[model samples]
Target: MTDVRVVNEQAEQLVGAAETLFAAGVMARSGHANLSARLDGERFLLTPGFVRGLRPGQLATVSLDGRVLEGELSSVSAEIISMHSAIYRARPQVGAVIHTHSPAATAFALAHRPLPCRTEPMLRFGQAEDVPVVPWGPRGSDVSVRGISDVLERRPTTAAVLLANHGLLVFGPDSAATAHLVVAIEESAEAEIAAAAIGGAVDFPEGAVEAVRASIARVSA
Candidate 1:
């Protein structure tokens, strides 16, 4: 069993991230979102209800096998158990997963279109290929889980994907990166849409992604 204090700490992180996303205008019109972080290889802590105004006690501890190990999961949250679990199983290195309906990104999702990797933020975050769109499926169904897992498997470098006619799904090595990726993707999507009014957004020159990667390596060094 994971320590209660540790579980609460993860919950607190979700709460803080929720606040940040809300302030950044990423939450859906209904203020609904879900976030989770791995507690261990065996289980994770998930947001149990609406993201806005979330509290730590309102979290659910779920086993990777899909069991509710602790706390109560709201009905809506219950449905997404498989959706998030699939990501953990497919990408063992991922420490966090977030789902949101940020408007601009959802517009791309709604249109079943991928968000092009034309913006610097997208390249900086390693999104060289356009953010792929997962085919629509019934929420939490095997089909939905399969769609998400398959896309992640095919695009190993992508940190985010648009859920067809639904919203956005993002995962990363940690909560902060996952949150930041969602924001960057949404901003990029908004820019892409607005840029359509002029001449449409343009892709970066060849090797732009590699250039960004080199810059990151230099900064780290």
Candidate 2:
């Protein structure tokens, strides 16, 4: 049996994190995103659908097989759960996953373009010059899950991936790390857009990029 207490705590934390993101303007007015974390050995705690703005006690627990645990909320996000399940199955090191439709990040995704790395912050997260886009599949379909899995399998060091015409998904060693990644990606996206407006060559200096990567490694270590 899953550990009920741990699941409940994770649920509460997930909701709280969602609310914090909403307050920070990272989430849309209707709560279009989902956040999740692993619970015990075999299950995950996820935000329920249409919960609107999240609150401390308003999350749900779900089994790996996608069954909703009783007594919490119902109505989970099918696509979100599918993506998270595939990620967890493929990457055992990831303890938390965050999906958000923050305007800047979603804008790049909708355009089917990668955000160019033009600053040190972008290099700090995996030294990725461009955040790759996973091709779209029918929402709530296993195809979406498999597509994302394939990307991660190829780029295991990637901290985030953009879903084509959808939004962004970030995974980390824990919820806090995942949250940090979301903020980093949003900032990088904003920087890339702003730099393009100037219409000149713009890139982080190599020495600075290496320094930022070293700092990130220290923190991650």
TM-score of 1: 0.95
Model 2 clash pairs?
A: none
Error of 2 at 81 (Å): 1.6
Residue 73 Cα positional deviation in candidate 2, in Å, after optimal superposition: 5.8
- Cα lDDT of model 1 overall? 0.87
Candidate 1 regions off by >4 Å? Answer: none
TM-score of 2: 0.84
Instruction: Give the TM-scores of the predictions, in the order they appear.
Output: 0.95, 0.84
Each prediction's whole-model lDDT (CA) = 0.87, 0.73
Tens digit of per-residue lDDT, candidate 1, span 1-221: 78888887788888887887887887778987889999888899898658778888888889988889888987778999898999999989998999999999999999999999898887776567899999999988999999998998899888889999999998887777788888888899999999999999887898988889999999999
Query: Lowest-lDDT window of 10 residues in candidate 1?
Result: 120-129
Worst 10 residues of 2 by lDDT: 70-79
